[model samples]
Each structure stands twice: as C-alpha cells, then as structure tokens.
Target: LSTVHIESDNANNTLIAIGGDNVYLTFTPEEPLLLDSIVVTIAGLATTLTESNGSYTATLTLTGSEPDGILEFTIDFKDRAGNPGIQVTATTDESYVNHDIYPPEIEIISITSNNSDSTWAKVGDSVFVTFTASETLDNISITIAGVSSSYNELSVAKYQGYHVMDDSNDEGDIPFLITYTDLGGAIGPDADTTTNNTNVQFDKTVPEFSLTRMATNNVYGDSLAGIGSVDTLSFTISENQRDLNVELAGSQKTPEQEELNFITTHTFSESD
Candidate 1:
C-alpha cells in the first residue's frame, strides 16, 4: 500500500486539520485490490475505503473533543489473490491536527494619552493603548473615538497601538474597541462601544480666568506704594483647578482659600 495524501476540509494539501473538520486520507494500492477488502483506521476510528478514480479514500470527522496531537493512519487490505497486507504511517512534516480548539481571550491593559499630567485628551495628542491576550494573535487593530488604527506586537501575548486625536472626535468620556484574530483564524469580539471600563475624557476647550481688584487705598490709585497699605484681589476661574499658583512682585503665593465656582482671594501688602 502507498499513501497518496492526507488533508482536511479546512486546509487542503496539508496534514494539519482544524478542529471540527473532516479529515480525508487517500491511498493507492501497488496491485489491484478486491472490493470490500480494504479497511482504514485513523486516530483509532475505523473506516472503510471507497474506490474513486483508481484511488481509495477514507474520511474521519472530528468532533473537536479529540486530544490535540499528531494523528496516525492504519491501512489493511487484501490483493486479488487474497494476500493480506498492512501499512501504517503517521502525519508527515511534524504537523498536528485539532491543536487549536479555543479562541484567544483578550483583555485591555490600559488606555492613555500623551498628556501624562492629566487624563484629558486634547486635539493633536497621541492616545496610546495596550492589551494582553491568552494566546498569540495577528491582524490586531484598535478603535478610539471613532478612529481605527492597527496595533504592533510587543511580545507573543502583548500588543500596543496609538491614535492621534483630531477635531472630528467627540468630546466627553471616550471609549475604545479592540479587534484581533487568533492563530487559529478565529475572529475576536466585535467593537465594544458600550463599556466604560477603558474610557478617557476628551476636552478641547481651554480654561479661562479673570483677575479683579476688590479694594482701593489712598496711598496709590490701583496699587499699594508703602508699608501698612493692603489691597485685596479676587481670582475667578472658569473651572475648578488644582495646584493653582499666583505670582506677585516676583514671588509665588498660594490662595488663602477657595470658594464655589473656583473663586479665590489674596491680600497683598507692600513694605519699604
């Protein structure tokens, strides 16, 4: 007996067989064989060969519950004179079948922006994203703020990518989506826009503030000239701010107190 080829319905002309696919084994006999005298077995499953175009073929369907490993085939047949012969062969080229049964599981590690000081993303800023997977993947892509971009593989299980912010993107909390394909050609989950777990705030408007004089003294029209004279100034900001600082006469000073709507006051005194 001579083995012609071994393949599967998913990939033709290859020994590797994907899970849940039918594996076909074809062989040709050295001498003409009698009908109903050929028996074939693969992976311990017995099958009968049918003559087709001068060659005999046997098919075995995998239910995806088979262990992931190499497969072997056994052929037993009898010639026209009833001479029995047996042939055994293994999958060639160190190939395996049914190795990949489960799809890759992916998780988002982090989604950040170039602005390290804040989580707010602005126009022209680069938004970075990183993730991990249970298995190696390919054709990775990430979508952020309606922009889709490809990712780079940093390692077998880690990937990173970035997208530049633009004016077309919407403001407020922004969510991202990730799509990938595992080594088994399994497509990952669709773009998830409803999850807020990896959200980043996007803001384009700049904060504004105003300074006003709250007190006047006779020593100077709008400023303090000498010792014992004091002038109070009020600082009003459009939004709440943290670590606010004020520069007065080449010196830095912190607000005495902060009030509602981001209003702060400071009293300055001049000395000779």
Candidate 2:
C-alpha cells in the first residue's frame, strides 16, 4: 500500500459547523485490491472505499461531533492475494479543515487623543484608538464622526490606530464604532461608543472674557489710587476655564469665587 492522500470538497481552513461536510480520500494499491475490502475512518466515522479509474476513492460525510482542529483519518484494505494492509498515516499537504463553533470576542480597550488635554481636541489634533480580540482578526476598522479608518496590528490580538481631526468634524462630543472579523470567519460584535468611554470634544471657537472692577473698590481702571489700597476685580467669561490665572502687579492670583454663569472674582491689596 502507498501513502494515502486526503482532500476535501471544502476549501482548506474552511470553518465547519455542526452540519455535514464531504471529504474525499485517494490511495494507490501495490497489487489488485479485493472487492468490498477497503475501509476509511476519519474522526471516528468509517466509510467504504471503491476502486475507480485505477485509484481507490471514498467520500465521507463529517456529520459526527469532532474536535475543533485538524481532522485525522486512517485507511484499511486487503489485496487480491489475501494480504491485509493498514495505513494509519496520511498527508494533507497542510490543506487542513478546521472546526470552530465559537465566535470571536472583541473589546475596545481605549479611545483617546494626543492633544495637550486628552478630553478635548482641536482641528489639528490626533485621536488614538485601541482594541483587542480573542484571536487574530482581519478587516478591522474604527469609525469616528462618520469617518472610517483602519487599524494597525501592534501585536497578537492587539491593534492601534489614530485619526486626525479636521474641519469636517463637528464641534462637540464625538462617538466611535468598531468592526472586525476573526480567523474563524466570524464577525465580531460592533463596539459602540458611550459617554463614559469616549471623552474627546472638538472646540474651535476661542473663549472670551470681560474684566471689570468692583464698584465698591477704591481703585478702578485708569483711576488714581492711594498707597496700600485694596481692590476687587471680577471676570465674566463665555465658558468655564481650567487652571485660570490672573497677573496683577507681577503677582499671580487665582479666582476667589467661581459661579455657574462663568464669573470669577479676585481681591488684591496693593502696596507702594
């Protein structure tokens, strides 16, 4: 008996489900083979092989439960001289059939930005996105503000990419969506963005503010004041400012009071 060669009607690495799939095997005999003396078993399922066109061929339907890996098969036959022959090894040339029933599980690790403050982004800012999967994947992409971009593989099961902010983006909080396919030909669940996960905001308008001296203060803008006088200044801003600092007479002062209307006040006592 010669080496048995295995082939499948389904393509190599083709994902097999619970249903039946056909596999064919062929082998050469050293002498004339006996009729009804050929048997082939694959994954614990047995089938008979018949001689056809100078070759022994058999078709087996893989309907039984098999492990989630390469399929192994064995062949047994007898010659016309009553010599029994058994071949337990076969070559598939790496053309393997895989069985996988579970789909890929995907998770978005982070969606961030490279701006000075990760919470906000400007027109020239770059937003970074990262994700992971249960297995290696293909056709991976991330959609942000209606724009789609592909991801680069950083390592096995990890991917990273970035998108630059442009004028086409809206001036508000933006959401993201991700899609990918695993090696088992399963489509992963779409990762939808939420307020708690995504925090980048696009703001283009410059914040405005107006400064006014308190009416009860002894000093006003362009007004003469005596030595050692105390003055209070109020600032009304268009929006809330973080780390706001005010410099008066070469001294830095923080806001004494911050209000919902975006108003901040500072009091200072001057000398000399």
TM-score of each: 0.75, 0.74
Give the candidate number with the greatest lDDT.
Answer: 1
* Tens-place lDDT digits, model 2, residues 1-272: 55467655543234342236576667777677876767777666776566776688766776536666667777777888878876555654544445554556675467778877898888888887777778887667788766886568899998876788899888888677888766645567887664246678887767787665543335464344445444445668777667777765455666566662332333445543
Model 1 bad stretches (over 4 Å):
1-4, 11-20, 28-35, 46-56, 68-73, 79-81, 138-141, 190-199, 211-220, 242-245, 257-272
Query: Number of clashes in every candidate structure?
Result: 0, 0
Poorest stretch of ten by lDDT in candidate 1: 260-269
> Residue 230 error for model 1, in Å?
3.2
Candidate 1 lDDT (Cα, whole model)?
0.67
lDDT of 1 by residue, 1-272 (tens): 65456767654324445566787777777788877777788777886467876788888887666656566677777889998876547533334344456666676467778876547788888877778778777567788777887677888888877788888989887667788776556566754542235556888876777664455354656554344544455667776556677765455656565652332333445532
